[model samples]
Target chain A: MKIGMMSFAHMHAYSYADSLMKLGNIELVGVFDDDLERGKKVAEKYLTKHFSDQENFLRTEMDAVIICSENTRHKEMVLNAAEAKKHILCEKPIATTIEDAEEMIEACKVNGVILQIAFPVRFSSPIAQLKNLIDNGELGDIVAFRTTNRGQNPGGWFIDKNLSGGGAVLDHTVHMVDIMRWYLGKEITHVDAMVASYFHDIDIDDAGILTLEFENGVIATHDASWSRFAEYPTWGDVTIEVIGTKQTIKVDAYKEHIRMFTSGAKSLSNVFYGNDMDFGLIQDFVECVQKGKEPSITGFDGLKALEVALAAYESSEKNKSINL
Target chain B: MRKIVYKKLEKIDFATTTAKVTIVKSADQLTEGIETFLVDEVNFDSVINDTDKVYIPSTLLNVVNENLYVYYELEQYPFFKKIKEVIVNPKGVLRFRRTGIITENQRLIASDLVVFSAILGEPLTIQVKRTTPAVTPYHTIVTVNFGNGTMAHLEYTFSNDDEKIELEWSGIKQIIEFNSAEMNPFSLKNYTSLPLAYSVDSILATARKADQNVLNRLEEFTSLLSGGVTK
Candidate 1:
């Protein structure tokens, strides 16, 4: 199968290339970047043919396209890709706005092409296990959950409101929302949020907290921020604690249960962690394409996550809970 | 071909923050005894530019350490300043990554800390490698002393074509201790202490959440394992 890349500006664009390369069956036709220099640089690094113009890249005889552009540009790119009848692998936080996300979803549907969001976390072995546990009724019903995905502050176009839409809240919160929907097997009915700019002085919020109530009455709280430093042992983690009617499951990923702290300072001189989910997710995406099945993380899934993020932001702005 | 790998490293613990970079290039591209500061002074550009190449300027870098001040002649010009000489200990390069107060304020970015690995060259394929459990053979575990205490460490064997590989985690220890006088147990050879801190222990919380999420998803895998695709 031939696959083309739409943009390389997004952080995951390189990863998408890496994924496509590892899958083997997919031939990378070419890639385009908004800036020719950056595009060429990325194409060189990934060793793929690159097109300087978007039109030229889209016109390639490719079976699919992966839209790994900025949040705001996703809609137009998706629409353009759909017009070309290319199945899509758009990155998460699919669009900065709900309208754009809806438009992209509709466009993909109308084109009769699969539109998958790049929510690779769902494909992780552990996360897949979590889904199984829920489906098997091991946890019974989720009572309350708290999720977080913090990291060091990021710069570039991500800090610009016009380019990235919102800051940490928009970029980070969407993942939690997506995972929540994935686990709850229900929609997020309402949200109460508190957004802040306590970290670095940027145009957008560097931190945010959201309270979510699922349609099934299960509640959850999420914290998304750029909180890591150069001195901390670990960069970030995503954890969930669900108090279901049956059991309480907690995954302690960073507990170097068997680690050595250097000196009197425990600056995580050495950490024992693994990042195996990436391979599994890529394998699943490739299989989905080969089998003509929808990707594990679909465009509809991407829209649902964005909807929660947008609702949280609107809720934070109004100082009230948003009803979804 | 040039490659980079993280080894037994040491770092400093601060009520504030800092980053210590140790770059050893196979190519003689690096100037010997050069102290480059990658400060995440998030808003440094909007603030001030050092006239002398004394300190490098970056908008995304922060200056969290205050103890050791390395001086260099700033290559001052109309537009930007370049580093002429960086006066570091030559022992290791130090720069601030973040602070406690700064870390406390940034609890909103807890969703994007995922580690997704993929191949760099031809044929175009991607896969999500498990980032936990230190799977043996491919990932090895060793002991590292960060000065006053013990650290359980895991290092992965390098694949032939890994362009960029990173270790990610949630930093949530109450009081971190890294500065040791005698041997300086910190890993001076590598970039240490990539703090992933968040408000109210967001890191561990998120990990637990991810665990549960994964546990729930495992049912599907279990079904596939059981030769049953139908729900």
Candidate 2:
């Protein structure tokens, strides 16, 4: 399969590009990034061609395109990729607005192409085990879910409102939301949030606590934030505790690491040596495209998760529970 | 069995448990020179001025008289007490995001309130979401924002006959986990006749500083657990 990357804006793009090179029977045809220097740098590292013009890049004979532009640009990129008849693996939180998400999903549907959202936490081994436990009724009926996806502030354009849309709430919430919806096969019906800007001196929210109610009467809470300090050992985490009638189980996706006492400024750290979820995600996308199967994590799935995140902001603004 | 999990006890007779105190169910049970009255949380309003000393069982809403003493089970848990000490200072730590608690009983979040207040000062908002309709629910999650502009998320799960409390904050290279053991007796952590005085004062200040809406939500939560209604 021939694949092309739209941009190297989100850091995940680097990991995905690396995965493309390692996987068998796949070729990263080229990379198209508006930022010429960054595009050139990544293409050079990956030993691929770089295209400055997005139209020229999309005109290439590629089966799929991975969209890793900033949050606001995802819609334009996806629409353009769909117009060119290239299958898409768009980053999470599909777009900044609900309308944009709806449009992206519709554009792909009309073009007869698959649009998959990037939710790498769903690719983690522990998360898969939890899903299996729930599916097999090993944990009985799930009653509640407690989750967290917190990371250090990825400053650059991530904190910019126009570029990334919102702060930690937008950046972090969708990953766990996608995981939960995938696990329970239920939709979130309500959202209540306490959004704050405490960690850094930024005007955008650095932290948010979301209280969500599922259609199945399951209550869940998620702490999504960019609140990890500079000296903290690792980046952040995606952890969940599933409360079932028979048993309760907890999964920390980034837990498989060795504790290392560093001589450098970061005094202590956990050296993660687990499944590279990013690779797993790219591998799955490749297989789906190879077999002409619809993407497992569909664009509508992305829209549903984005709805919960957008509701968190609306709930914060309205200061009341938002029924979805 | 000397095991007391302290899950919102409505009729715990401190008189029977302690050596010095006495429970005043009626005038006959009261001693001739009964100077103190041990009362649970709900009856504090009725017996405000009836005694020189009131042994508060679980938690109180507002700051009452100086005679009312708060006995927090958190003081008995060495691990939580150590965390409380760190939270009060928090000089080097940048931020503490979320706290997860699991236990055998849905014990009062009184100690949690104290701990959260120590981190985030006065609570500006309080919201509770529970999983089951069971009076003793299997799961409950609470979100609160303090007057200091910081927020805290706490999740409590009632595991059957097993006790464990796990507090987690992630993404800094290290993930911390705490598993609970049986609590020991309280030590001389405070001054004369005032145990957990700082904590009690902070919780009261939090209550006093909170808006009426926040307090009402807390009241509703207590009522729901006690099989009653609050107007």
Highest TM-score scorer: 2
lDDT value, candidate 2, whole model: 0.72
**Model 1 TM-score, 2 decimals:** 0.58
What candidate 2 gets wrong by more than 4 Å, as runs, is B1-56, B59-69, B88-107, B110-115, B135-137, B168-231
User: What TM-score would you give candidate 2 relative to the actual structure?
Assistant: 0.79
lDDT of 2 at B12: 33
lDDT of 2 by residue, B1-231 (tens): 011111232323222334343344532343455543332224454444444344443344445454444454444344555655554322211222222333312335644565456565766666767766573336666666666655555666665443345555332233344443212123442212222112322222222222354445445445444442111
Best by lDDT: 2
CAPRI verdict (incorrect, acceptable, medium, high) for model 1: incorrect
For candidate 2, write residues A100-147 as lDDT tens digits. 999999999999999999998888999998999999998788898888
| Candidate 1 chain A weakest ten by summed lDDT | A250-259
Question: Positional deviation of A221 in candidate 1, in angstroms?
Answer: 0.8
Off by over 4 Å in 1: A252-266, A269-273, B1-231
